[model samples]
Target: MPWIRSHITALLATLLVATYAAATEPPLSLRAVTAENNEPFNIVFNGKLQGLGVDVANEAARRSGFSLQTEALPWARALETARQKPDVLLFTVARTPEREDWFHWIGPIAKREVWLWRLRTRKDVMATSLDQAKQYRVGTSHNDAATEYLLAQGFEQGLNLDITMHDRAIGYKLLASRVDLVPMNPLSIGAFARESGIPLEDLEPQMLLISSGGYYLALNRLSKAETVAKLNAALVEMKADGSLQRLLEKWQPKGSKARSPSSPP
Candidate 1:
C-alpha cells in the first residue's frame, strides 16, 4: 500500500511538471506562407528564401519572440494552407473585403503601385489618358489585382499572359505593335528589367495608374487570438520606431523610378 501511494504521488508530480512547462513555454513553431514565384517580394534563392516578405516576416518573428518557418507554395495553395492551419501566417497579402473574413490581418507593412508600361516608340498609345489607351490592346498577368482592377474599370481589350515570362515578351510585343500597353507592379517590372539586362529606358511605366496599395501579414482565424495580438503589437512598435520603413528601403530595388507626379487619368 505504501509503494502504491508513492507511485501515485510520483505520477501526480510528473503531470504537474508537464502542465507547468506547457503553460510557460512560448509557441514552439509558427508557419508562414508566400508565393512560390513572387520575386522581389518573396522568392527562393539558391535553396534559401529572400525578399521583402521574408525580411518583414523575420523581423516580426524576432520582435514577437517566436520562431518562424516558411513554405513556398502556389499563391492559392499558400493562402488555403494559411486558412486551415491554426498557427500559420501569410505574408504580403493585399487586404480586401472579399478576404476580410478569411484571416486576421496584422498590417499594411509595405506599399506598391500599379503602372501601365508601353514602348517609347508607340507615342500614340503613350499619350496620357486611359481613354486613349482603350484604342489598343493591353497585356496583363493572370490572377493579378491589376488585371481585375482594369477589367472592373471597363477595359475589356486585354491579353492574359503568364507572369513569370511576361517581362521578356512585353517589350517585344510592344515593339512589334502586338500590344499597346502592359500593366504591371512597378517594383516587379524594375527588378525583371534589371535581372534580364533590359534597359529601363526601353521599358518604362507610361502612367502610374494606382498610387498605392498596402501589403499585410495575415494570421489564420483559427490561430490563438493572444498570439495574433502580440504579433500586431510588435508590428506597431516596428512601425513607430521606423524599423519597418528602414527594412523596406533596404530591399527596394536601387534606382527604381519613383511614381511620376503627373499620371494619366
Candidate 2:
C-alpha cells in the first residue's frame, strides 16, 4: 500500500510540472496583411486595425496559440506580399477559382456578394448585363477579385475599368460621377458611403457580379503545414462551438442574418 501511494504521488507531480511548462510557453508570432480602408471588414480606424476581419483573424490566432500582427496595405500590395512572402497571412480574401491555389486557406469567415453600383442621380448610367455594364466606365480596386473577374471577361483597364489603389476610392469615384459604375458589396455600402461623406441613398445597385464563395483567411502556401492545420482547426472549433456565429452577430448590423456554416471554396 505504501509503495502504491508513493507511485501515485510521483505521477501527479509529473503531470503538474508538464502542465506548468505548457502554460509558460510563449505563442508563435505571425505577420498578416489586409487591404486598406476595407470598412467593416479590414478597417483602419483611429490608427488601429479593428473590424470583422481583424476580430476574426485575431480570435483564430489566439485559439491557435499564435500572436498575429496585422498591417493594412493597398489591395495589390497585400496580395503580392502574401503571394511572395513566406509565413504571411492575408484575411478577408475571396476564394475565387482564380485564387484557389494561391494560398492555404483557413476560413470562409463571412459571406458577401459583389455588385455594380451607380449613382441614383446618374439616370443615364444603366447596366442590365455584364456586356451592357462593359459599355460604361466602372471603378474597381487594384488586383481585387472583382477586377480580376472583370478582366477575365475582356474588360480592359483605361478603357472601361478604372482601377484605384484604395478600395475607398471606388465609392467616391461613383459619387462624383467620375465612374459610371463600381463593383462593391451592398452590406458595406453604408459604411463605405459614410467614409466618403456621401449618403447611402445616393448609390444604387445595377448588376450582381459575384455571389458565390466567401471571405477567408489566406495563409501563404509556403507556410508550415502544421501552422495552417492549427489555424484551420481553430476555425472549425469556433464554428462548432458557436463562437464564430456570436462574433458574426456582434459585428453584423441588426436584422442581418449570419451564416457560419459553409465548405471552403
Candidate 3:
C-alpha cells in the first residue's frame, strides 16, 4: 500500500511539472513588416497603423499567445526583412510558384488579380499579350515578385521595363505617359490611382496578367515549425469561423465588394 501511494504521488508531481513548464514558457515573438501605404491591407492612418492585415496578425498573436511587433517600412526593405529574419512575417504576398518556397505560408488573406493598366487617353498603350505588352514601357518594382514574374517572361529592364521601389511611382509615371503600362492588383488599383491623385476612370485595365494567386502571411523559412504551426492553426480556426471573411468584408474598398470566398488569380 505504501509503494502504491508513492507511485501515485510521483505521477501527480510529473503532471504538475509539465503543466508548469508549458505555462511558464515565453510566448513566441514575431517581427512583421508592413508596406507604408498599401491601404486596406496594411496602412497607417491618423498616426495609427491599421488595416485588415494588421488586425489579422494581431488576432493570431492573441490566439496563439504570441507577441507581435510590426514596423512600417518601404516595400524593398520589407522584402529584405521577410527574407532574412526568421520569425519575421510578411503579409499580402502573392503565393506564386516563384515564391512558394520562400516562406512558411498562412492564409490567402485577399484575392488578387494583376493587370496591365494604361491611360484611356493613350490609344497606343494597349497590348493584347504579355509579349506584345513587353514591347511598350512597363513600370515595375525592383525585387518585387511581379517584377520577377515579368522578368522571367523575358522583359528586360530599361529596354522595355523601368524598375522602381515605390508602387505609387509606377502609377504616377503611367499618368505622365512615362511608362506605357504598369502592373496593378485589382483589389488596390483604384487606391493606388487615388493616392496618386489620378481619377480611377482614367485608368483602364488592358491585359489581365497573372491572376492565379492570392496574398498570404509568410513567416521566414527558418522560423520554428512548432510556433508557426500554432499560428497557422489559430488562423485556420479564424477562417472556419468566418472571422477572416468578416475582416475582408470590413476592410473592402468602397465601390468594390469582397468576394464570398476570395478567388485565386
The superposed Cα distance between candidate 1 and the true structure at residue 102, in angstroms, equals 3.0
Ranking, lDDT, top scorer first: 2, 3, 1
Q: Worst ten-residue run, lDDT, model 2?
A: 256-265
On residues 39-74, what C-alpha lDDT tens digit does candidate 3 reach at each position? Answer: 778888999999988999888877988888889988
Please give the lDDT score for candidate 2: 0.83
Cα displacement (Å) at residue 210, model 3: 0.7
lDDT of 3: 0.82
Output the TM-score of candidate 1: 0.77
Which pairs of residues collide in candidate 1?
A: none
Candidate 1 lDDT by residue in tens digits, 1-265:
9999999999999999999998788855787888865667887889888888888888888788787878888777787888888889898776655577988888888775777887666667753677766666777655556666667667774343223234556556656777777776666767656554667677766776765546788988888998899889989999999998888787766666533424442
Per-residue accuracy of model 2 over 27-49 as CA lDDT, tens digit each: 88999999876767887778888
Judge candidate 1 against the unseen true structure and give its global Cα lDDT, from 0 to 1: 0.73
Candidate 2: clashing pairs of residues: none
Give the worst 10-residue stretch by lDDT in candidate 1.
Answer: 157-166
Off by over 4 Å in 3: 1-27, 256-265
Each candidate: what lDDT? Answer: 0.73, 0.83, 0.82
Comparing 1 and 2 by TM-score, which wins? 2
Tell me how many residue pairs clash in candidate 1.
Answer: 0
